[model samples]
Target chain A: MTDKQRENLKNRIAVVAAWGVALIFFFPIFWMVLTSFKTEGQAIAVPPLLVFEPTLENYIEIQERTNYVKFAWNSVITSFGGTAVALLIAIPSAYAMAFNPTHRTKDILMWMLSTKMLPAVGVLMPIYFLAQKAGLFDTKLVLVIIYAMVNLPIVMLILFNYFREIPKEILEASRMDGTSTYNEIRQIVMPLAWGGIASTALLSIILCWNEAFWSIVLTTTEASTLTAFVASFQAPEGLFWAKVSAVSTLACAPIVIFGWLAQKQLVQGLTFGAVK
Target chain B: MNRTLVRLLQAPSIILLLLWMIVPLSMTLYFSTIRYNLLYPEREGFIGLENYRFFWTDAAFFPALMNTLVLVGSVLIITVVLGLAISVLIDRPFRGRGIVRVMLISPFFIMPTVSALVWKNMMMDPTTGLFAAMWNAMGWQPIEWLQDMPLFSIILMVSWQWTPFAILIFMTSLQSQDQEQKEAATLDGAGFWSQFYNLTLPHMARPISIVILIQMIFHLSIFAEIFVTTSGGPGVQSTNLTYLIYIQSQQAFDVGVASAGGVFAIILANIVAIFLIRAVGKTLTV
Candidate 1:
């Protein structure tokens, strides 16, 4: 083939290959969505029914069988609640790390990171006991606190990077040094770092929603998020596959939409700024 | 005013972390050395090293450790390799590239329980699963996934979730690849494979390492998938350290043994974190 002809051929092959991988990767989700529209019998039908009358029965049954709204509200409240608290705690420290730049800043940052490195299960028992002893077990407040603590390192790191990106000369020229730290952070740093702060919030919210171990262990009925509620199904018997699929779809739908909108931020935040 | 609006407002976080680093961990240390069980709170005493011994000698301990290694290692290899290929495939302009990219990355956002369940029920279930149908359509017996290869099943579940993460990172970095070098290599008769090896692969080195380290940190602690899919069963076939510890604490209520297991997890995670932080630190310092 001529060079131009060969290039066109290669392009065609790449398009086919990309679409193929994408569809295969995405098939489980599509199946879950499709299966949600089928009856339980049809869901587990041998030779897997390709075409069927889609039904809203599963969704309605799922809502009745489990308190779907309660679980969803828990997820929303905990994830957003946790992110807000994390930001509140992280902003000033990140501010110091970014602009103040003490000799010990690097060590402090590293030390903060090491705390995260301490696996959640390592401290699971003590935290569990403390929560119960303090009457915080199975409470949304308790989840909020734990999620904030777990996500603190990442939140601080992202905010610090964003804060650091604010031009130093602008800070000096604005005479923000004379202002109180809170006002300066409020007026100056917050506005300049809005994009980073937003993406950081998005990233943390997703993490909290997807968080499993802590949510499952720490909360039982009253405060359990969608993740914990969904874990209750755990392949019990052979029935409820349709209901399980429906619940899974509903639990993940909002976050999945949010995740798609935040893909660019996910790369930046998740890579810890390692990738450009 | 300046020094610590950062430090002052930061005190709660810093101090909480400091306390987190010191207090509860030291409590865990104390608990590890003592005999404490949530079941028998009244029976408490100093039992230095006994809990550690009991946990070490548990039947499932070693198998769980091995399962952890196999799962993390396989997932890391799969994600990096597939992530690189998929990213490169979609890197150049193509029809519906954005939509394809979105579809590929959607799994990462799925909660672990949801993905594991979806896979367990929809895809991997032997009789009723789609894989069963596919195999039967081809005139073969469907393999029981969770029963036959529990660890492999968990690996598949996790790899699906994470391959997207690696792709997102690798694909983003790939876009910034120096095109002039590719053109130069092309003019010198370098085909796609050679350019991929010499140029694209070399460019992806840092991202590959970053993906591995970061994925390792999370993979090492994988819990929910195993919890939902197999509960470390058909035996301890799929149990990893995290789930094993969960069983000890929550199931058995043996806090002391669980605490010892916790110490092991902490030490293991710290080893990985040193490399991860170093990688992150290098990027930051630059």
Candidate 2:
């Protein structure tokens, strides 16, 4: 082959390889979605039916039996509520650190990030007991508070990074015009950094929505989020693969879409601005 | 603006974090030193270091620790290496690249319990699982993945979920890489391997470290995968420290001992966290 043809061949091979890897990585999720539409026998068939008559029976049955909406609503409440509360607290704090950082600001930021390193299990007992005593066990309020606290550092850090990018001269300009601090934030900072704020909120909501460790540990029925709801299928006789897949699909669908949208902020939020 | 006012604005997060850190942690410490089993409430008393001794001496402790180390180490190696290769593959534009990126990252967004369940039921179930069917098609006996090789199975599930995270980071970082530098090196007669080794790797050092550090923090307390699939069973073979502590508190109802285990987990996480803070802290100042 000529050199030009050889380059063409290499490009074709790379494209094929990329597609193959993506398909393979995505196969399990595809299989789960596919399985959710299959009949029970089809779901467990020896060859595992990739081609079958899709059904909504599993979805209906799951909703009827487990009250899927309740769990989903619980997830919605906790995640959104948590994001709102976290933003409420994180915004101003991040504003202060970003615009008027002191010598100890970096230390304070790092210290907050370090709080995330404290394993949930370390404080699991106390939180559980405290919640129980306060009549807050298995309640949406408690989960919301905990989730907010858990994600507060990340929310703060992302907002701080975003706020820091706003030119100080703008804030200075607003200040020189006799704009109050609240108005400066409300008008100048908020408008300037809304994209970052939205992305931070999006990322926090995703984390809260998908958080499994605390969701499973801290709640059972009343405030059981989708993570806990899906986990409830872990029992031996609960091996109805079709129904489980349906529930899992529902639990995963919203966040997966949102996650794709917010993928840009994911690295920064996850790494605590360590990378970018 | 006064420094006091800045401090006032920052107080909520700082104070909340301080209370969140100090209160439960101190309670855990207090519980660790006392005999505070909920099952035997009568046995509550000061037992300095006794819970620690028992926890250290438990038969499951060492295996769980080893499993934790192996799981974290193996997943890190697999995800980072594979993620780099995949990122490099898709770094250059191609047909359907956006869809490919979306498909690859979907796994990372799946809730852990859901992914674990999907893997356990549909992918790894030896008899009815896809792996089994593939094995049988190849004229080989199917392996009981979670039954025979539980820890490895857990490692595979976690790596699958996290590889996309590595890809996302590396791919994002790759976009920032200097194409001009690569071209200059190529003009200097540097082969692709040498260019990658001498230039690409050096540029990616910080991102690679970030991936490692962040993955370490998340992987150390991995709970749901184990909880859903194996429950740290088949004779504690797959139990990690987190699972072990879970069993201690939730199953055995030994608060003191579990608190001791919690303390150990804190210490281990802190070791990694200190390194992480130093690495990331450098970037913060810049």
Candidate 3:
């Protein structure tokens, strides 16, 4: 066979292999969704009958057992609230670092990124103490603050990259036209970099939505996010696979749908400044 | 008013981040040096270096450290190698490429808690999980995954969630590969493997390092998966450093020991960060 035929055959094999791997990766999620509709017996069946009669009994039972709407509402409030607060802080910080970068700018950026590596357990005691002392424990405000701090680094990093992509010439031109720094940023910079900022916000919201460690530790029943809600499914009477799957499905649905809708933008934002 | 107002606008964020870092860290440092235990809430006082000494002497310390290294190292290697292969395969145009890409990347976005629970219940559960069902269908006994090999199970769950991230980075990097280099290599009779090794690998080095560094930082603090699935169980066999700290603080109520462990974790992470920054700086121009 010629080289061209060999290349074509190789490409075909590669594509087939890639598809197989993708399916394997996606199969667990498919199984979880499938199990959510199965009866308790069917969910834990020995042979795991693939052709079982699907039912919504698990969903109904989960709803009856737990306040699904309350948990969902808490998730929405905390995730969006955290994202808003983070953006409010990160925008100015990123703006300062991007446009008026001083000698300490890189260090500041690195410091913020390093904060992410600090294990939540490290500060669990102090934060927990502070929360209790201040009566902020299990409150939405506490979650909002913690989530903002947790996701601040990624937000700042992404926005800094976005702002850097907006040429310095544009900002300089706006300044030449007598636009104030605030006006230049609001009118010229933000409008030009709106796509990047929006995507960064979306990514931050997703991160905050998915954050489990602090949500589980810092909150109980009051302001628990979806992660805490799902974790509460762990009961003393052994594991409830069917009901847990139902809860898990509900918990992950919003972010998964958001991901599906904004996949292109999400991908772009995650890979921001990664390649170049 | 201009300079004062500018500083005023920035003060809240700067102060917040400063306090956020300093307060917890200083508390951890103070707690590390003292003989503090939450269970005996009133028995707190300075015992300089005692807590650190205890942590160093503890048998679980080295094992926890090694487990952390093993977890991070194994996941980084597995994800990068698999990710590169998958990314390269999907780099070329193919039918249903977009769907395949989405399917692969979707796992990364799944909440870590849900991912862990799904793996534990549906895929890794010995009796009724998919693996067990498959084994039963083949007339074989089911292998207990988390029960028998807890660390491996945790590693598997984490790798499943994070490999997608590596693939995303690799795919983005692959898109920027120079077609001219490949054409020239082909003209010079370079085979596919040779071209990939010589040209593609060199181009992908920076992204590979970035993925490894980022994964190391995150994976070192892996908590939710271990917490949700096993709770560092089967006698702390799967207990990485973070889990060990959690057990120390929450279960044992030994704040000093936990804080000491936290300091150790901080130092370890900083070491990794320093190496990563130096390595990436050597390769990355901007």
RMSD of each: 1.7, 1.2, 2.3
User: How do the residues A102-196 of candidate 1 rate in per-residue lDDT, one tens digit apiece?
Assistant: 77777777778768778888998899989999999999999998889888988887787788788888778667457655566688888889888
Better candidate number, 1 or 3, judged by TM-score = 1
> Which candidate has the top score in lDDT?
2
CA lDDT, every model vs. true structure? 0.88, 0.92, 0.82
lDDT of 2 by residue, A178-234 (tens): 998889889999999999999999999999998998889888888999999998888
TM-scores of chain A, one for each prediction: 0.95, 0.97, 0.90
Look at candidate 3 and tell me the lDDT of residue B214: 73
Indicate which candidate wins on TM-score: 2
Evaluate residue B209 in candidate 3 and report its C-alpha lDDT on the 0 to 100 scale: 77
List candidate 2 segments past 4 Å from native. none
Task: For each candidate, report its DockQ versus the true two-chain complex.
Answer: 0.75, 0.79, 0.55
Q: Residue B96's C-alpha lDDT in candidate 2?
A: 93
lDDT per residue (tens digit) for residues B38-73 in model 1: 789998899989999999999999999999999999
Candidate 3: segments with Cα more than 4 A from true spot: A236-238, A260-276, B1-8, B277-286
Q: Which pairs clash (backbone N, Cα, C closer than 3 Å) in model 2?
A: none
- Global CA lDDT of candidate 3, please? 0.82
At residue B12, candidate 2 shows an lDDT of: 96
- Full candidate order by lDDT, most accurate first: 2, 1, 3
What's the candidate order when arranged by decreasing DockQ?
2, 1, 3
Tell how far residue B207 is off in model 3, in angstroms: 0.6
